[model samples]
Target: MPRSMTLLVLLAGAFLIAGAAALWLERGNAMLLDLSSSVSSFMCL
Candidate 1:
């Protein structure tokens, strides 16, 4: 494959891994709920 294509594939793989990690860490709904609540309050102000 071309150099650019190889780089793109590596980057895409890394992004997928990172996203999977983040979702795993936030497996429970509590954290997201808290975050959304904070954002909602901030938006109302």
Candidate 2:
């Protein structure tokens, strides 16, 4: 039972880390897209 509990805790930690990493990556992508769009509009003007 103790071993199973430990395994569960580890799995939970892994999932949390993965979620945080995905969120960070998505935010970075959005920032890049926004910058690119702004640059294109400025160039057009």
Candidate 3:
């Protein structure tokens, strides 16, 4: 039982590290566009 608990903890820690790494790698790859121009166009219409 103790061994299984240790394994579970290690697995959880690995998942957390992997998730953080993915976010760090993707931080600059993700793009957000300016929506104000589109909103203004819609308002003009």
Candidate 4:
């Protein structure tokens, strides 16, 4: 595979892992309040 394609695959895998970790840490709140709070913070800017 090309270097760019390999890099893209690695980045995607890392993103998935990080997302899973955030959800695991947030527990049930991951789907709702977590996203809402982050959006709200962005809106405040």
Top-scoring candidate (TM-score):
2
- Estimate TM-scores for all models: 0.58, 0.61, 0.58, 0.59
Candidate 2 stretches with Cα past 4 Å from truth are 31-45
Put down candidate 2 lDDT per residue, 1-45, tens digits, no spaces: 699999999999999999999999899998989999999999999
CA deviation > 4 Å runs, candidate 4: 28-45
The lDDT of model 4 is 0.90
Alpha carbon deviation, residue 14, candidate 2 (Å): 0.2
Error of 4 at 27 (Å): 0.8
Q: How would you encode candidate 1's per-residue C-alpha lDDT over 8-34 as one tens digit per residue?
A: 999999999999988877785778789
Candidate lDDT values, in order: 0.92, 0.96, 0.78, 0.90
Q: In model 3, which runs have C-alpha deviations exceeding 4 angstroms?
A: 28-45
Is candidate 2 or 4 superior in TM-score? 2
Summarize candidate 3's per-residue lDDT along 1-45 as a digit string, tens digits. Answer: 699999999999999999998897677344322355676788999
**Model 3, residue pairs in steric clash:** none
Q: How far is candidate 3 from the true structure (C-alpha RMSD, Å)?
A: 5.4
Residue 12, model 4: lDDT of: 100
Indicate which candidate wins on lDDT: 2
